[model samples]
Target chain A: MEPLTVPGMLPALEEIGRYVMAAAAEAGLDKRASYRLRLAVDEIATNIVVYGYQPSGTEGDIIVSSTIDDHVLKIALEDTGPEFDPRQHAMPDEDELTRPLEDRQMGGLGVYLAFEGVDDFHYERVDGRNRNIFVVNRPSAAPAT
Target chain B: MDVNIRSIDDITVVAIEGALDAATAPIAQQQLLPLATAGCRILLDLTGVPYMSSAGLRMLLSTYRQLSGKDGRIVLVGVAEEIQDTMSVTGFINFFTLRATPEEGIAALKG
Candidate 1:
């Protein structure tokens, strides 16, 4: 599928999600896998828009592209906003996740869940843009299109 | 996202329709947070919510924190399977009572 370029803003998240869903559908991902991919993409895209772009007081576009193979489906999000790596962010530990609501820390849960939901996640700074790659293994029974 | 609030006996039924994600979470928060008062019972009807991201989870956590130790109760009804799985992974599912339907959720809140 063709790559989607959406403005890195809060309102553009819905468009980003639609692009991801379309890619997932093209890959013939099942409901569970599709939802996971969508969540993973949504989380990182939000971070790019909210933390990376909005805070910098500059506007940018998030470039989302996907590729499907017999083995896995890969989605990549590229943004030219400030260089930020989600992997470097501190995720909630097991204790934090299990802690009572009042005792749990609020930040990082989204990033944590985003990476954890996918089969594999990778971050790289290619040239000047930050690229986040998410991989979800296609089920064996799913026919290759 | 659309948030509709109605009173059922003493419980406030907040029905949210549409995807509950970062784009729409603030709207849900704006409408739902004000209903979290001391000793308030809230039944969140999510039958129309086809998808939810961590933003929605954060809103739920915030609401839960507000009601904690205040004798307030909150229940979730008609949670989609995918949303439930996301909540389970984040451990947010354990924080609230889940029911299959609004009737069950209202009963859970009352009981």
Candidate 2:
């Protein structure tokens, strides 16, 4: 599996998103599933860049690696930023999600969708580095257009 | 991302193409928020938008908030199915009116 390492910043998200989607497609993920994989990776990468590195003005980089096992694709993102477990943030409750636009709050919504789009999500603090792992199960056939 | 703002009768249409991810969402927000706040009846044409990330959701939510207080409405047109799934899962799909085409969206907004 080829690994991609890039500076941790919002601008890097465009390239990162493209890489993850290509990896997903290589794993035979359908269009919808590939989109979800891209979404999941983008959310986590954005969080690491925006909340993890940018705030402290620390120069850091995110390393992304992907592997396919059977029909499942596993993508892992490793960053040297401060260890903040995105899973620790509680997902937005249904009430919060369903609230009227005037009353809806933005907290946790991005992280919530990140988790929602993937089949499984795991976070680990390895050797003082933050590692986020995501898995997507690809369907045998693409959805009908 | 390409953002084209036009007017069809009483509806203000903003046509966007490309992925509405983190990098592009801010650009869209910058362009759409001002119009939404100005109480323009807006129809977001997303036929060219193949995907949208959470940042896009935030922009839509903010636009909704801004338009709600005013006598303004926000309608979505040509939203891709995958985008619709994300919106449905996040529970934000119910807040906006969705149509298959920009003409339908404009019609709904005008009606």
Candidate 3:
């Protein structure tokens, strides 16, 4: 699918989701896989906009591009914001996840869910750009369109 | 996201009719949090929501926290399968009462 470049802001999240969903549909992903892919991308993109760009007091654009191979669909989100690696962030442990509602902390839940929702998540810094990649395997029985 | 709020015999039924993600979560929070006052009973109808990211989960947790000690209660109805999986992954699913329909949700909240 063609890369989608949108401003790194909150309002652009919906557009990002739309781009991911379209890519998923093209890949013939099932509803569950499609939703998970969208959720994973949305979570990381949200983090990029809210924590990466908003905190730095700078504005940039998020470039979302997708590629579908025979066995997998990979989506990459590239942004020029500060060097923020989602893998470096600590995910909530079992104890933290099982905490009572009143005591539950909201900090890392999104990042954790984003990584957990996808089949594979990778983070890298290439030439000063943060590239977070999410992959979901296409079902073997899914017929090619 | 469109949040519709109504009362069914002291149970505030809020039906959300759109994707609940980062962009729309704040809007949902603005409309749903205020209804978490003391002794409030809420029935959240999520039938119209086809997708929900972690931002939606955070908003739901925030609402649950607000109603924790205030004797308020909340029940979720018509949660989609995908959203339920996400909620289960985050452990947020254990905090709320889940019902299959609005009638069941209202009954659960009332009981």
Candidate 4:
């Protein structure tokens, strides 16, 4: 069990994304799955940077945990800044793409895309922390194209 | 991020060279918004853009929506194949215009 604690800022997002990607690949996750994992991790990290904590101080942080068994990559993100439930938000409308720009809305598209990209996603606020856990991977024995 | 600005057929052309992911995305949004409001035909040459993320999508889509509201134009030029695949996966292929190059994007914006 390895863990990383970030102060919950936008710049740190890519750092954590890279870390997750490297760990996922080392654990034998597929290439496509790894990119999807990056996207999911970015979404969650951005959420923490934006809504997880107040701007005045640095008491809040995001903690990421990883566990690899065989080829499975299970990742968890827990933040103690604020109580946020991304799962409760509705998915963005993909059809909004072709709509004239005037018809499109400005926010929430990433969360929906993140939700659609991952396999198993869960969100929970447990004992004063917002915990998000998701799994991404493919079998190590899967043939490489 | 590398930006190359040029002019062709009376349109201001900007070529972005890099991955428009979580890190470099705000730059894309910030730079493109000014071009959008300038109200001339604008072409974003993404031929050099190898990849784009949700942050980048939000910028593009949000700018597209804002420009369309003002009856302005934004054209897509040189979107890479890999980006097209990501766009399709996220259903953005159906949302924004996909162009082969800057000239074609300018033509499409005019139409």
Model 4 whole-model lDDT (C-alpha atoms): 0.73
TM-score of 1: 0.97
Candidate 2, CAPRI quality class derived from DockQ = medium
lDDT of 4 by residue, A33-108 (tens): 7777777877877777776664535467788888776545778889887677888766656576545445666367
TM-score of each: 0.97, 0.93, 0.96, 0.80
**lDDT (tens digit, per residue) of candidate 3 on B57-87:** 8789889989988999999999999999988
What ranking of all candidate models by TM-score puts the best one first?
Answer: 1, 3, 2, 4
Maximum-DockQ candidate: 3
Candidate 2 has what TM-score?
Answer: 0.93
Q: Per-residue error at A52 for model 2, in Å?
A: 0.4
B55: Cα error in model 3, Å: 1.3
User: Which candidate wins on TM-score?
Assistant: 1
Q: Between 1 and 4, whose DockQ is larger? A: 1
Report how closely model 1 matches the true complex, as a DockQ value: 0.81
Greater-TM-score candidate between 1 and 3: 1
Over the stretch B1-111, how does candidate 2's per-residue lDDT look in tens digits?
A: 889998877778899988888889999999998887555788999999988989999989888878776888888989999999999988888888999987788788878
Give the CA lDDT, 0 to 100, for residue A115 in model 1. 87
- What does candidate 1's lDDT look like per residue over A53-84, in tens digits? 88899888999999999989999999999999
Least lDDT summed over 10 consecutive residues: which range in candidate 4 chain B?
B81-90
lDDT of 1 by residue, B6-106 (tens): 99889999999999989899889888888999999999999999889899988898898888888888899999999999888878888889999999998
lDDT of each: 0.90, 0.86, 0.90, 0.73
